[model samples]
Structures are given as structure tokens and as C-alpha cells.
Target: MSYLVFEQVTKVYGAVEVVAPFDLDVPEGELVAFLGPSGCGKTTLMRMVGGLEPPSSGQILLRGERLKKPDRRRGMVFQSYSAFPWLTVAQNVAYGMRYRRDLSAAEKEEQVQHFLALVGLTDFASEWPNRISGGMRQRVAIARTLAAGSEILLMDEPFGALDAQRREFLQLELRRIQQEEGKTVIFVTHDVEEAAFLADRVIVFTRRPARILAEVDVTARLGASRTLELREGTDFFGLRNELLHYVRSTASEEEGTA
Candidate 1:
């Protein structure tokens, strides 16, 4: 059985359907990227998995259990700065563990230190969120989610706010963390290259009332862990261009209708 299941899940606001009846299966420890145009319902579908938005119909299942309300088990990292301005870097990461009943205070502190070191923020543990750069703040957000014991990460363009260089760096950072933490990630992004770089599999979506356009397997051809060097390789382009073809075809289809 698949680790995560989107069994005929859908989203609608009033009479407008943002997502059509959709179905997908994600395996454990795999990073799946939803790539599509703006307002294409990719994020909407992801939100349902996180339990942030209810599916108008169908269900989101994790390990065969239905997900209903927002839970710390499936944490989210948003595009905007999500760290608490008043909290220090360590505090932000530790904050998520406050509600973790299984962990003692000492265990929680250990987790905070572990994640802070994972994201290379151990030195800045005492620094405030407002004092750090945008990229650093995002690192804090990721650390917080993992420290809270969220095995499934729902990332909604978490690095989208950063510049190209910073974005690339964080992509690698996230990839490393995912590899080490053994987390299942459902990433939503508009950037084709970013999706290709980060995802083991990429699911392309059409315009509003989004439908699955294509699913391209990247790690089958590309290496398990991607780097800047791979970006210029033909194998990488093949993975990226394949996703681009599906993305562009959707744009063409929209234009023809209009």
C-alpha cells in the first residue's frame, strides 16, 4: 500500500471548483513535487493533505487512516516568513515540540539542538528571527516542523521568497534534510527547475479545476542527491525539459480555450 493516499480528493469554493476529483499515491520517504501555473489548484490539493483545507469530497489517507483536522504529524512550511519575531532561532524550533506529549523537556531540548545543527543554525540558536536573513528564517521554519515530529512535510513554495542563489542553496538544504530525516515531502512549486531539482517524482497540473497533466520520474535518470553541477547536465535537462513540455502544453491548452 502507498504511504500517503489522495483518494478522489477535491476542493471547491462556493460554486467554483478549484480542483477536480483527483487521486494520487505517494510512497514513503519520497519527495513529490506538484508543478503547475499560478492558481492551478496544486497548493489547494496539498493543503487538503495537510488538513489545512477540507476536501469538498473524497478523502486524504495516511497509512490507511483518514486525515481530517490540522495535526502536527503533517507539518507545513509556507513561502512567507513563518518564524515568531520575538522568539530566538532555538525557541522557534522548540516551540513546535511544546505539544509533543511523548517527549520529556530534556528530549525536546535535544531535538531542538539536533534540528538546529541539521539546518546549520546551531551557532545562531540564540539569535532572533527578525535579526536573520530570509533564507535563515526559512531554515528555522523547516527545523521547527521536523522537531515537532511531522513525518510528512507539506511545503508550499517555502523557498520561493528567496533569490535564485538562495533558492538553489535551500533546495539542496531541504534535499539533505529530507534524506537524513527520512520524511515524505509533498512540495508545491511553480518553478520547473526547482521541481526537477528537488523531487523524486514531479506531478504536473493544469489550470484551475486542476487535473494531473503528467508525472515524471526524475531520480530514475538523475542522481539521488542533486547539486549545482548536475543542473548543467543533459540528464538533468531531460528531467526538467520533460516537465516543461507538460507545463507548456497546459498553457497552450488554456490559450486555445481563451
Candidate 2:
């Protein structure tokens, strides 16, 4: 069985069906992105996988084990700016390990340092949240999630709040962290370029009561290197345009029907 599996998963709220029955299976260490326009149920799908919300029907399994409820094994990053204003970068990361009474103080510190360095925020470890930029705060959020020992990371438009340059930089940073940690990631984004740049495979979805519309395999060869050259490469643009074309066509069809 695949590491993470969503089989005919659906979510309905009262009279409204937000996400249709959709199926996906991700191998143990793959990074996948969900791309679509707003209101397309991307966030809902991520929530379902994170176990924050239960599926109306169907199943979600990780490592062949069924996910019954939210647990520490799955981490999440939201679009909302989620850093505690009072906490320093290191403190923020340490917050995740608070509930783990089993770990000694020294062990928790080691985990915090490891994840901070993974995201290139070791220098900012003592800096307050307000002292750094939005991008940096988001990095802290990511590091905190990682420090919690979650093997699966769920990101919902995590970079949507940053400027273009920062967003792009963080995307590369995320890719690097994913590589180093070998974490299973399901990232949700509306940006086609973001999906193309970061994902091993891009899954597209339809409008509300969303279903998987298409899937594109992004085969960029960049490893842990975070050079701007990856974004400018022919493969990047090619894959990005393909996803954009899918979104545009879907939008056009919706307009015609309206």
C-alpha cells in the first residue's frame, strides 16, 4: 500500500457538498501539490488528510494505518500568519515539543536546532517574531511543525502572504527541507508556478464539490540547490504553462456554462 492514501474521500456540510469523492495515493516520500482556483476544495482536502476534519465517507490512510483523528504525526501550516508575537524563533519551534513529556529538555533543544538549521533560520533563532519579516515567520512556523516530529506535512497556501521574491525563495527553502527530511508533503496552492516549481507531481481539481481534474508529473532535476536558474529553466516554464492551460480551460468552461 502507498504511504498516504485517500480513497473516494468526500466532505459534505449539511446541504452543501464541498469536496467530491476523490482518490489519491502518495508513496512514502513523495511531495505532491494540489493546484486550482479559489473555492476548489484544496484546503478542505488538506484538512481531511491532516485529520482536522473527518471525511463524510471514504478513507484516509498513512503507512497502511487508518487516520482516525488529528495527531502529532501529521503537521500543518496555514495561510494565516501563525507565529506567536511574544515567542522568539527558537521558542516558537520549541512550542511544538511542549506536549512530549517523554523527551528530555536537551532532546527538545536538539530537535529545535535541527529544524531551524534545516530552514536556514539558525541565525534568527533568538530573534522575536516581530523582529523578522513575514517570510521568516513562516519559516519559523514550518520549523515548529517539523520539530514536532511529523512525518507528513500539510501546507495550505503557506507562502500566499509573502511578496513574490520572498514567496519564491521560501518555495525553494521548502523544497530543500522536504529533500533533507524526506517528509511526505501535500501542499495546496492556487499559484501554478509555485506548484510547478516545488511539486514532484501536480494534482488539479475542479470547482466546488471539487474532484481531481488532472494530474501532471513535474520532473525538474534541481536537488537541494536554491538557485534562481531553476525557475528560469525551460522545464519550469513548460510545466507551469501546462498547469495554467488546464486552469484557464476549466475557467472558460465554467464561464460558458454560466
Candidate 3:
């Protein structure tokens, strides 16, 4: 069985249906990117998976059980870096473990250190969130999510706030962490390049009432190292161009037809 399954999931707000019947099966340890334009239902789908909102119908299952509410198993990071201003970076990471009864104090501290290091924030562990760059703040959010013991990661345009260089740098770091930790990641992004570089499979969505327009197998063709230099290769460009074409043309076509 797959790690996560979306079975005919749909979302409606009043008279408007923001998501049409959608189905997807995601295996464990794979990073899948939901790519689409603004106001599309890509983020809505991710929110459902994170247990932040109820689906109008159908179900999302993680490891064969239905998701009912937000918990530590599904950790979400948003575009906005929402860290507790009062907490230092290390404390913010530890905050996620507040309810965890499985780990002792020493073990929890060890995990906080581990995840902070994974996101390259070990040096800033004691610094307040305001002292860090936007990029670093995002990293802190990520470490916090991971340290919370979430098996699945839901990232909603997490790198959207950063500049190009910082975004690219984090993209590389994210891929490395995913590979090492073997956690399933569902990344939501409107940027074609970012999706191409991060996902093992890129599920490009149409405009409103989101549906999967296309799914590109990235790792099969481009491989998973996903280094900065790989972005310039012909294969990488091909994947990026392919996603861009779908986002541009499919979005325009779907806007009026449906």
C-alpha cells in the first residue's frame, strides 16, 4: 500500500467548488510537488491532507487510516515563518515536542539539536527568530515541524518569501534532508523551477476547482541529487519547461472552460 492516498477528494465552499474529484497515491519517502497558479486549489488540497480543513467529500488516508484532525504525524510549514517571538530557535524547535510523552527531556533536547542542524540552523540555535534572515526563519519553521515527530511534511510555498539565491540554497538543503530522513513531503508552489528541483513527482494543477493536469516523473529522468548545477542541465530545463507549459496553457484554458 502507498504511504498516503487521496480517494476522490473534493472541496466546496458554499456554491463554489474549489476542488473537483481528485485522486492520488503517494508512496513513502517521496517528495511530491503540487504546482499551480495563485487562488488555485493546490493549497486547499494540502490543507486537507494536513487536517486543517474538512473535505467536502471523499477521504485522505495516511498509512491506511483516515485523517481526522491536525496532529504531530502531519507537520505543516506555511509561506509565513510563524515562530514564537519569545522562543529562541532551539526552543521553537522544542515547542513542537511539548506534548510528546514518548521522549525524555534529554532525548527531546537531542532531537531539537538534530533537526536544527539538519536545516543548517545549529549555529543560530540560541538566537531569537527576529535576528535571523527570512530564509533562516523559514529554516527554523522547518526544523520545528520535523522535530515535532511528523512523518509527513506539508510545505505551503515555504520558500516563497525568500530571494532567488536563498530560495535556491534552501531547495538544495531540503532535498538533502528529505533523502537522509526518508520523510514524505508534499510541497505546494507556483514556481515551476522550484517544483522541478524538489519533487520526485510533480503534479501540476489546473486553475480553480483544482484537478491534476499532469504528473511528471522527475527523479526517474533527472535523478535526486538536485544540486544547484543540475538546474542548468538539459533534462532539468526540459522538466521545468514542461511544467511551465502546463501551468501557462492549461491554466488559461481551464479558467474559462470550467
Candidate 4:
């Protein structure tokens, strides 16, 4: 059975439907990227999975059980700087664990340290969020989410604000972390290359009333090694171009109809 399943899920606001009814199954430990143009309901679908927004119709199932509200099992990392300015890096990362009655103080600290190291933020553990760069803050956010023991991660363009160099670096780091930890991730991104480089499978969406246009398996083309060298390969460019074509074609279709 799939780890996460969206069955005939639809999202609407008033008379307008943003996400048309669609069905998708994401296997355990797979990193799936939702790629499309703006207002394509990628983020909206992610939010439903995260339980930040309820689906207007249909159900989102995790492990065959319907997900009604936000739970620690599914964590979210947003594009914005979500860390608290007043808290230190370690404190921010440990914040989510405070609610867990199952973990002792020592266990929480250990988990925090472990995840911080995974994101290469061990040295900055005592530093405040404002003291770190944008990329570092996002790292802290990811560490926090992981520390909460979330099996499914929903990231909404977490690296979209970073510069080219930092974005690329974080993309690699995120892939490494996901692989090592064996977490299922649903990432929303507008960047074609970002989707192609990071996802095991890329799910392309159409305009406003979003529906799956295609599912491109990156592993078949890029293989398991996600190094910087892979980005320079002809196959990578081919897949990237294919994703871009989907986005552009969808946009052209929308414009023609409008």
C-alpha cells in the first residue's frame, strides 16, 4: 500500500475550483515534487496533506487512515523564515519536541543535535535565527521538522528565496538528508530544474484548477547518485527541458482559452 494517498481530492473556494479531483499515491520514502506554474494548486495540495487546509471534497489518507487534522507524523517546511527570532537554533529545533510526552529531555536534545548535524548546523546550535543566513534558517526549520519525528515532510518551495549557489547546495543537502533518514517528502516548486534534480518522481500540474499532467520518474534518468556532476549531464538537461515544456505548454493552453 502507498504511504500517502490522495483519493479524488479537490479544493475549491466559493464557485471556483483550484484543485480538480485527482488521485495520487506516494510510496514510502519517496521524494515527490509537485512542479508547475504559479497558482497551479501545488501548494494547496501540499497544505491538504499537511492538514493546514481541509480538502473541499474527497479524502487524504496516510497509511490507509484519513488525515483530518495536523499531526506530528506529517511536518511542513515553508518558503518563509519560520523560525522564532527569540529562540536559539537548538531551541528552535527542539521546540516541536516539547509536546511529546514520550521523549525525555535528554532524548529530545539528542534528537535535536542529530538533526542539526544532518543539516550541517551543529556549530550554529546556540545562535539565534536572525544571526544566521537565509539558507541556515531554512536548515534549522528542516531540522526542527525532522526532530519532531515526522515520517512525511511537506516542503513548499523551501529554497525558493535562496540564491543560485545556496539553493543548489540546499537541494543536495535535502536529498541527502531524505535518503539517509528514509522520509517521504512532497515538495512544491515552480522551478523545473529543482524538481528534476531533487525528486524521485516529478508530478507536473496544469493551470488554476490543477490536475496531474504527467509523472516523470527522475530515478530512471538521473539514477540514485545526486551529485553536482549529475546536473551537468545531457539526460538531466533533457528531463529539465521536458518539465519546462509541460509548464510552457500548459500556460499557452490557458492563454489561448482565455
Q: What is the C-alpha lDDT of each candidate?
A: 0.92, 0.87, 0.91, 0.93
Q: On residues 170-217, what C-alpha lDDT tens digit does candidate 2 reach at each position?
A: 998898888888998999999998888888888998888888889987
Which number leads on lDDT?
4
Q: What's the count of clashing pairs in each model shown?
A: 0, 0, 0, 0
Q: List the residue pairs that clash in candidate 4.
A: none
TM-score of 2: 0.94
The global Cα lDDT (0 to 1) of model 1 is: 0.92
Q: For model 3, what is the alpha-carbon lDDT of residue 6?
A: 98
TM-score between candidate 1 and the true structure: 0.97
* lDDT tens digits by residue: candidate 4, 1-258: 767999999999999899999899999999999999888888999999989999999999988999989989999999999998999999999997978999999998889889889999999999999989999999999999998889999999999999999999999999999999999999999999999999999999998899999999999888977989989989899999999888888889867842
TM-score of 3: 0.97
Tens-digit lDDT track for model 1 on 8-34? 888889999999999999999999999
Q: Estimated TM-score per prediction?
A: 0.97, 0.94, 0.97, 0.97
Model 4, residue 14: C-alpha shift (Å): 0.4
The weakest ten consecutive residues by lDDT in model 4 span 249-258
**Tens digit per residue, CA lDDT, model 3, 167-249:** 99999889998899999999999999999999999999887899998999999999877877888889898888888888888
- Worst 10 contiguous positions by lDDT, candidate 1: 249-258
* Model 1 clashing residue pairs (backbone): none
What's the CA RMSD for each of the models? 1.4, 2.0, 1.8, 1.4
Per-residue error at 205 for model 3, in Å?
Answer: 0.5
